[model samples]
Target: MLLQVRELKVGYASGADVLRGVDLSVGASSVTGLIGANGAGKSTLLKTICGFLRRRGGAIAFDAADIGKLQPSQLAAHGIAYLMEGHSVFPGLTVEENLILGTWAFRKERARAKQAVERAFELSSVLRAKRKVKAGLLSGGQQRILEMERLTLNDPRLVILDEPSLGLSPKLVHEVFERIAQMKADGAGVLVVDQSARHVCAASDHLYVLRLGEICIEGPAASFSDRIDELVRNFI
Candidate 1:
């Protein structure tokens, strides 16, 4: 597995547990969809794997290395990238500057960084058009695309996207899912959590239905699609 998460648990200092004993694995050439109701620990699991939330128990192993103990920056160095739920771009920076920031974690390699910027532009022509404009001025959908582009900048082996389609129109949501399909086709391991079950399943190789911080059902995405309406209702 490219990423292995076993019996993970997470909770705040004084709050109830948010993630309870979640286990998940993603292979190098697959896209996994994490679906569930609001506050069901989908985002929490992503955060735990990316080292944003401290795990209360269990382990996160990536490429045979224990990563649960690493800091966020260190985790990124280990080739894991996280795209959060909302627009994460720097509002004050130009689109080009925001894209450049994605390469900050890379070792000083001018050529590679430049190539990454160009690749990001190619992936989303909207960013290319507004490269010199402040990222804050872009539409919500465009900002989300920028965030995904930033996460892919380092060519991370595993990418975790939290609600990549949140609050977008159907047209924009379709575009986001298309990009995700392209990413999987490029052999990137992806773990995506989204409220839109049908769209996510369509793009995923496997599906995991999370309920109240625990996995309820998991299987091939194609199989789940046969009963997607029922499954989505169960999550809600």
Candidate 2:
């Protein structure tokens, strides 16, 4: 597995548990989907796995290394990339500049950075056309696309996304999910959390349903197709 999270627990400084004994796994070529309602601790799980939040208990292993106390930058260096909600990007910078920043780990290697940037451009011709434009000026969908492209610089082994479809039109949401699926095809493990359960089910290889800070159900994506409606109604 590229990422393995076993009985993980986390909470805020306020001392209330946000995640309680969550278990999840992602393989190098798998697309895993996590679906839940607003307060189900989905975002907390993502943050904790990426090392943005401290874990109160349990373990997180990425590429076979325990990462319970690693910092966010360290996790990224260890081949994990997180594309947070809001499709965050450096709005004031040009597309190329933002991509260069994504190559932070290899900044001293100018030739390698250049090649990585070229690969990013190849992901979307739209990005190539707007390579000189400020990121803030692109349409919302374009900005989201740019955010995904940035992950290419690191060529990460595992990719985590939170609500990638948020604030996007239906077509844009489909496109974004398609890009995530492509990551799996390219041999990168993907762990995605989204509110759109139907969309997530369609894109995932495995599905996990969380309710009240716990996993209520988990199985291969196809196994839940028949129960998706009822599952969403009861758990999501």
Candidate 3:
């Protein structure tokens, strides 16, 4: 497994537990989907795994190393890229510059940086056309794509996405999932959280249905799709 999370528990300063005993894992060759309601702690789990939130208990191991206490910067240096909700980009910077920022740790690797940027451009023509434009000027969907492109430039071993498809048209959402699928195909593990159950199921190799901060059900993506409504009704 590229990432392993076991019996994870976390909460804010108020001491109200948002996540309770969550167990999840992602592999280099797979797309792992986590689906749930608004307050089900799906995002919290991702945040904790990436070091945005401190875990109250349990362990997080990445690439066979215990990394529960690492900071976000350390996690990024260890080959984990986190795409927070809203697909945040450097609003003032040009798309190209934003992508360059993604490779800050690899600033000395000139050749590899160029190759990564080119690969990001290959994901969508909109990016190639507006490479010099300020990221804030792009449409919502376009900004999301740019954010994703920026992460790709980092060449992360594990990519964690939180609501990548939020607030986009159906077609644009499809494009977002398509790009996520391409990530798994490229041999990077993907841990995705999306409000859209159908899209998540479609993109996932393994599916975990989270409810009240716990995994209520889990199985292959195809199995969940076969009986999604029934499972969603019972668990989510």
Off by over 4 Å in 2: none
Off by over 4 Å in 3: none
- Candidate 2, 1-85: lDDT as tens digits: 8889999988887667888899999988889999998999999999888778899999998778888888888766787889886
Query: What TM-score quantifies how close candidate 1 is to the native fold?
Result: 0.95
Model 1 lDDT per residue over 184-223, tens place: 7777899999999899899999899988888989999999
lDDT per residue as tens, model 3, 1-236: 99999999898866678988989999996899999988999989988898888999999999889999889888668888889976589889999998888888787899988888887787679999999999989999899888888887777889999999999999999888988988888889999999888889988999998999889888899987878777667766
Compared with the true structure, the alpha-carbon lDDT of candidate 1 equals 0.87
TM-score of each model, paired residue for residue? 0.95, 0.95, 0.95
lDDT of each: 0.87, 0.88, 0.88
> How many residue pairs clash in all the candidates, one count each?
0, 0, 0
Give the CA lDDT, 0 to 100, for residue 193 in model 1.
94
- Lowest lDDT 10-residue stretch of candidate 3: 227-236
Candidate 2, residue 28: how far the Cα is off, in Å: 1.2
Ranking by lDDT: 2, 3, 1
Among all windows of ten consecutive residues in candidate 1, which has the lowest summed lDDT? 179-188
